[model samples]
Target: TALAENHPNLLASRHQLAGAYLADEKAIVILKKVVEMYETLPEDHPGRLALQHVLACVNLRDGEPERAVAILEVVVRNAEALPEDRLNRLVSQDELARAYLNAGQVKKAVAMLEDVVRIRKAQPEDDMNRLSSQHYLACAYLAENVVEMMAKVVQKGPRRLVS
Candidate 1:
């Protein structure tokens, strides 16, 4: 039954249901509907940001990182709008950086990751998030063969873990 879904509770059932679609060929269609619903939801509605975040993932998985970049850039701009929602912005940045890299735009990827590293370093966040940005930036540096920078990041070992 539709009621028996991946999301454990009613609170996230709709979003969770979307997850089921994420795994199926039907994902694209379901995602389109989700984007529509998401657009109709009120600004600052409790679940809206999460929904948009998921939609961005769907776009990426559908092999449309450029589209993901568009969605994520908007999400990034709103990072400070919701402190609790900042994680989504961070995630989007990570994906957007990769999208740029995949598109043969390593310079842009490195630039994006550089900004990510700076923001994450300046703010208080979960240790994992800090680690993620550090790792991503490190890889971006390495990919560009910025050996000096990569070595520094490697030496640091996830800024939080280093300290």
Candidate 2:
């Protein structure tokens, strides 16, 4: 606490602490505080955007998907200035899709995840990010009741899974 107070801008430490607290019910409070500190940074600053992403994840975990969507929307928009293949931009897009899913916007999630999956497909098939995006795309399809899409994803098999 003293360290946080003395070095409020020490985002790396704050982010680490927030991660450690995520399993606790009070995680939202701690993450909110960290996000507040990050507000002092520029809107597009990587640290600020990364903290916002974490906050959005916490919101999703707490069943506050609307809040997660709101936060992730901003993060995704800001991240657009980054290169298409940038890790942060890709991650922001993926999380935004997840937020959409949790918010019950299955169609939107499906569309976004499809795009993410397409991008990830350009990476090595063994890439974890590609596999993760494909998995999420399948989940979105399942949520949308697109059984054919889900089946295709499943048929891709584990070895073909991207990110």
Q: Judged by TM-score, which candidate is best?
A: 2
Which consecutive 10 residues in model 2 have the weakest lDDT in total? 1-10
> Relative to the true structure, how large is the alpha-carbon lDDT of every model?
0.69, 0.86
lDDT of 1 at 14: 55
Provide the lowest-lDDT 10-residue window in model 1.
2-11
Question: Please, what are the lDDT tens digits per residue for candidate 1 over residues 1-163?
Answer: 4543233353365566778878876766665565566665565554665666677778777788777777666665555465533666677677778766655567888998887788788666667877787887787777777656677888878875557
Per-residue alpha-carbon lDDT of candidate 2 for residues 63-117, written as tens digits (9 for 90 to 100): 9999999999999999989888888899989999999988889989999888888
Whole-structure CA lDDT of model 1: 0.69
Displacement of the residue 17 alpha carbon in candidate 1, Å: 1.1
Q: Model 2, residue 71: displacement in angstroms?
A: 0.5
Model 2 off-target regions past 4 Å?
1-9, 146-163
Give the poorly placed runs of model 1, Cα more than 4 Å off: 1-12, 42-46, 83-85, 122-126, 146-163
Clashes of each: 0, 7
